[model samples]
Target: MVNVGIGLAVGALLLFGGWVVTAGLATRSVSAVNAVFLSYVASLGIIGIYVLLARRPITGTQTDLVFALLSGVFLAIGTVSFYGALTRGDMAIVSAIAALYFIVPVVVDVVYFETNLGATNLLGLGLAVVAVVLITV
Candidate 1:
């Protein structure tokens, strides 16, 4: 319970901080591309420093390394595009649309991974689609 709570708290803090920074920069006339770069680099530096200070070994197996690299590349593309949209559109609407990107992985799980998505999961997916439509239109 303590571990789950810590995870939830940390994840929320990270997400909230990311959104505030992105929106604040976008509203302050910073170009979306630059904002993405700034945020990415700053995050890398801050986290890297922390890991170093903690005397932790920065280690990953080969498969983990590949996945980590791919994750960073994929995230950079998405974050850059999202920040770009934020610069030109209402944050509320843009974020709602961008948030729907999570559906991709959900779909991949069902299609590619053959994961069993129960009725509740299917309904959740339907609701997510409805949400995107509501926000977009």
Candidate 2:
């Protein structure tokens, strides 16, 4: 059995750590696009190996496929934009701006998923925006 909360925590931790490393290493490269591309290539290799080892079927329902493809597209766009921003600005500032990306999912959940958008959630969202500003400055 898997723990969803643990998975989320680990995933978020990895994202933060990976971004920090990417910010530092990408600076050594001349082209941010190239850096992003190379990272994806490496991911391909890792994922390929994992698929081979796990021996899981590389198939899914139409819904799964659509969402998986969309995830890849969104992540690719986000990573490229983040790397480009990292090259041109402070890592903290770029990461803070990137954190604002959460707002999209939250809004989508409220509007489409019929999620409860309580006052506490609204206040948290406002604080998130304020935090980005405070941290960047």
Candidate 3:
């Protein structure tokens, strides 16, 4: 439970940080792709420094590295899409729509991943989706 709360807090911080960075990029640049690419480069530099200081060895398998790279690519694309949306749409609406990604992991787990969900958990997810809809609408 504590971990869950911490994860939520971290997720909120990421969203807020992303929004601020995206807004700043929009003010200075016209290309969302450029902004996302530069952001990823900066993130990579920061992460590399952290990993070096932590003395963490890169021991992951090729498949794992591939997946991680794919995740980074998708993140860059998503960031560009998000910034473009923010530029064209209301920030509140865009942010709420972006928050739908939270519900996606649950859906993916339950459906494609064949994971089980309790009745209570299903209800909670439903409520969350409803809340997102309400907030965005």
User: Of the pair 1 and 3, which is ahead by TM-score?
Assistant: 1
Q: Give the TM-score comparing model 2 with the true structure, all chains together.
A: 0.85
TM-score of each: 0.82, 0.85, 0.77
Clashes of each: 0, 0, 0
57 in model 2: Cα distance from truth in Å?
0.7
Clashing residue pairs, backbone N/CA/C < 3 A, model 2: none
- Segments in model 3 whose C-alpha atoms lie over 4 Å from true places: 1-29
- For residues 82-126, write the lDDT of model 2, one tens digit per residue: 888878888777777887988998989989999998899899999
Can you write out model 3's per-residue Cα lDDT over 1-137, one digit (the tens) per residue? 56998999999899776656566557354666666667668878998999989997777999999999899788777888887776677777777778778777787888999999999998987897788789887
Give the Cα error of residue 136 in candidate 2, in Å.
1.8
- Give the higher-lDDT candidate: 1 or 3: 1
Top TM-score prediction, candidate number: 2
Q: CA lDDT, every prediction?
A: 0.81, 0.84, 0.77
Candidate 2: segments with Cα more than 4 A from true spot = 1-4
